[model samples]
Target: MDKLDKQSRTIKFFRERIPAFACIPGCHDCCGPVLASSVEMARLPRKSEQEQDAALAALSCPHLGAGGCQVYEERPLVCRLFGTTPRLACPNGKRPAVMVAPALEQRVYRYFEQVRHVLV
Candidate 1:
């Protein structure tokens, strides 16, 4: 398989994996502490954190606010990968974990445009 095919498979794999952690909509703080960022060092909350502060902290997405996920357009990788399995412990003291699924990948990419916008 070529590089494009390989990448496509990877995206498909992740889409299936992350959904294991289905994120309930309108839950206020679906993603707890350490909201995913694109600027610099923004690591997904490690399972080993033991204690996740659990606060409605500011997320890196320009789209996130009182209204929630605004930019939806220019979001980052992690946001795209939100709802996975193992339900990354809710930093907000909630149990049943959440996942992030932005359905943009289902569409085909342009010839010159290259990016896994969908199956992140």
Candidate 2:
């Protein structure tokens, strides 16, 4: 498969295997200062300068909408994997019944690195 096809498959598998719980109502504390690849950032909708400033000042993601994430479907793997990994568990104490397998997590990490490396 081509790179795009591989990326799609990887993301699909990762999302399916790594479950996420509902975040606390009206809480976006974890949305701040997230690191994402260029491809992931490109998928997100642009934010206004004022909105960007506010998000930066508040240390939150610029794409964090009033209701929730503005680009939920297109959100990066980091966003999708949030609250699933042990090191990045949800602050609200919500957790999935099955955690992502170590091998699967390693694959996801490889995907991230590959995407970033290819873009850069």
Candidate 3:
């Protein structure tokens, strides 16, 4: 496979492997500024420079809506990792019944290191 195809598969692998858990109703405490790979960003709605600056200044995610994450389904791997790993535990103490395996988490981090990431 080409580089693009490999990266795409890697992204899909992590997305599917990451476990999901119940979050506190109406809670978005973990929504904040985060870095996303170009591949991930392409899946999200565009935000203007002004909007990006404003959200960064406030230390909030540009995609965080009044209700919750506006792009929850398309959120980056880091966003999905939140509350799923011990390192990024949910503020409300919510987590999957089984935490992400250390090896898997490290592999995700390694992927992040290999990719070009930008603030989202």
Candidate 4:
């Protein structure tokens, strides 16, 4: 689909914007063991590949430390798309809404839905 690159780009944009706008300059556990998705395993950079199997087995990010995401750039979609709020829901119902950049989710989901084979 022509949307592949664009959608990934969009996910990239929101991925950055979401964290920069919300959880910056604070203690963020975005890379914590609790919320860190299995997706993180697939996104780990090649540099960390040797540890991927171990990390996945432990379910602890190889790049994660006492501070935060060591390889934030190579973080997963869930990490990229996380919001500062404790929880988020939208008028769409079903899903609990919280404050987040609307355009960001749209872009991220676009990529996720389209390029299921690749990282969103």
Candidate 5:
């Protein structure tokens, strides 16, 4: 497969393998400036400087909205992996009981390496 295809499949793998948990409702303590590949950031809508400043002031992600992540569907792998791994545990203590499978976790890291160069 090509790089694009591999990236897409890797994203799908992450989505399927990573466990999900219910974070504290309306609590965006974990949302903030995130380092992500240009490809991933391109999937999200751009934010104005004012909005970015506001989000930074509030200690929340620029994409965060009243309900939750405004760009959740296309959220980056880092966001998807949040609360699923011990290394990046949820600050709000909403981690899932079962962690991601070791093999899958390794694959996630591998993919991160592949994209790390392009990450901003």
Candidate 6:
């Protein structure tokens, strides 16, 4: 397969490996400016530069809506990683029943290091 396909598969693999959990009602404490791979960003809805700047200035994510993450289903891997690992624990003390293993977390980080990421 080509590079894009490989990256997509790697991302899918990581996404599936990470555990999921419920968050405290109306909590978005972890939503903020974060780096996402270019492939990941392409999956999300486009936002204007002005919107991005405004959100960054407020220390928030441009896709974060009043209710919650507007593009939650297509959120970046880093966004999905939040509250699923000890290193990125949820402020509300919520997490998956089984946190991501250190080995797997490190692998994900390595993937991040290898990929071209852009602030979103």
The C-alpha stretches of model 3 lying farther than 4 A from their native spots are none
lDDT of 2: 0.72
What digit string (tens of lDDT, one per residue) describes model 5 on residues 1-120?
Answer: 887677767677778878887788887777777766666767778888888778778766788878888887888778878888888888777888898887888888887777863322
| TM-score of model 1 (CA atoms) | 0.35
Give candidate 1's root-mean-square deviation (CA, Å). Answer: 12.0
The candidate with the higher TM-score, 5 or 6, is 6
Query: Model 5 segments beyond 4 Å from truth?
Result: 48-59, 117-120
Can you write out model 3's per-residue Cα lDDT over 1-120, one digit (the tens) per residue?
A: 987788889999999999999898889998889999988888999999999999999999999988999998999999999999879999789999999989999999999999999999
- The lDDT, on a scale of 0 to 1, for candidate 3 is 0.92
Q: What do the candidate models score in CA lDDT, each in turn?
A: 0.37, 0.72, 0.92, 0.50, 0.76, 0.90
- The list of candidate 6 runs beyond 4 A from truth reads none
Q: Each candidate's TM vs. the true structure? A: 0.35, 0.76, 0.97, 0.51, 0.78, 0.97
lDDT of 2 by residue, 17-102 (tens): 87766677887666775666655565677667787778778788777778887777887788777777887778777667787777
Model 4 agreement with the true structure over 52-116: per-residue lDDT tens digits: 55665666656666676676676666655555323442222222244456666665556555554
- Against the true structure, what is every candidate's RMSD? 12.0, 3.3, 0.8, 7.1, 2.6, 0.8
Candidate 1 per-residue lDDT over residues 15-71, each given as its tens digit: 444433333565546533323222212222222222222222333223345666544
Q: Which ten residues in a row have the lowest lDDT in candidate 5?
A: 111-120
Question: For model 1, what is the alpha-carbon lDDT of residue 77?
Answer: 39
The superposed Cα distance between candidate 1 and the true structure at residue 36, in angstroms, equals 9.5
Please give the ranking of all candidate structures by lDDT, highest first, separated by commas: 3, 6, 5, 2, 4, 1
